[model samples]
Target: MGSYIGKTPTELEMAGNEDEEDALGFKLTVLRDAMIHLRVQFLHFQSFYEKEGLENIGNDLKAMKIILMVVQNKIEELKSIIPEYLEIKNIGMVKQKIEDFDLVVTEIVLEMKEFERDNFLMEKVEKLINKLNPFDVPNLETLDQELSPNEMMKTIMSKSAKKQQDKMNKETIQNDVT
Candidate 1:
């Protein structure tokens, strides 16, 4: 909404070296835009077919998935553009950090790639919305208490959070006794 609207992402805001960030940012944005374009293209295909008829969509899905994979590979490629940072002193920890970094980056990119796919869905969503009448909404607003936040939303404590709290309380009680 501010200065970043038309400008590229600044070097420091990104994780890699400044030159790498600059170069990669431009390239990534291009690829990201291409991904978005493909998404739009697919949506247009979907809408054209939905309104007209279902042409063979099998190849279309395959092509879209391949594009998604290329985008994923590019995301992994960014990690290579910079030296890896190690949080721990040991070699094993550094190795683990590398794996962890890969996992986190992959997770984030995959999430974004999913959004690419979602954008395709959104482009054709209006037609879908029109196609689907009010009766098709599945009445999920009242399906489950957890899913609904209507005063009846029951919260569940995850096991680890509960265990940590219990351990803290036990430690506090022990300290008081001492």
Candidate 2:
């Protein structure tokens, strides 16, 4: 993520100024596009499994299709609700819809991949679903800035510390063995 260095989300929203709505529209658009992509992918996999006569896998794909349909409905609902919520500045319903969409995506991913772990098509669907989760919305407010510079530095240091500790432990074990 690039650093917004000196701008806030409110500032960016003001900059856009076309309609005084929350900048969440971009996230919604991405979610819709991702759903379309997922639908096409599921359809393709369904066709492949059908041709291969993999009945069970085909059924799983069908379930995935159903999940997509629900997701599509939720996206539509959010589309309408977001503008109204923004105007009133009450986003409770909007937040709830997003949460619901996230839950359905989670269910689809699990249903498609968990039981039939080895089904290659299902595995692909699961990964795609995870990648496209709407709740994983990028914060445009921070798009102009690194979202977590401090957290990132801490993670890097922690990883290095862990690596050194593991190496020391391994050396000690080797000495004992010798």
- State the C-alpha lDDT per candidate: 0.42, 0.55
Candidate 2 C-alpha lDDT tens digits along 45-90:
6676767756546655666667576666656666565655444332
lDDT of 2: 0.55
By TM-score, the best candidate is: 2
Stretch of 10 with least lDDT, candidate 1? 136-145
Positional deviation of residue 33's Cα in model 2 after best superposition, in angstroms: 0.7
Tens digits of per-residue lDDT for model 1, 94-131: 23223333443343334435544643333223332233
Q: Local error of candidate 2 at 84, Å?
A: 16
How close to the true structure is residue 70 of candidate 1, measured as C-alpha lDDT? 60
Task: Report the poorest 10 consecutive residues by lDDT, candidate 2.
Answer: 138-147
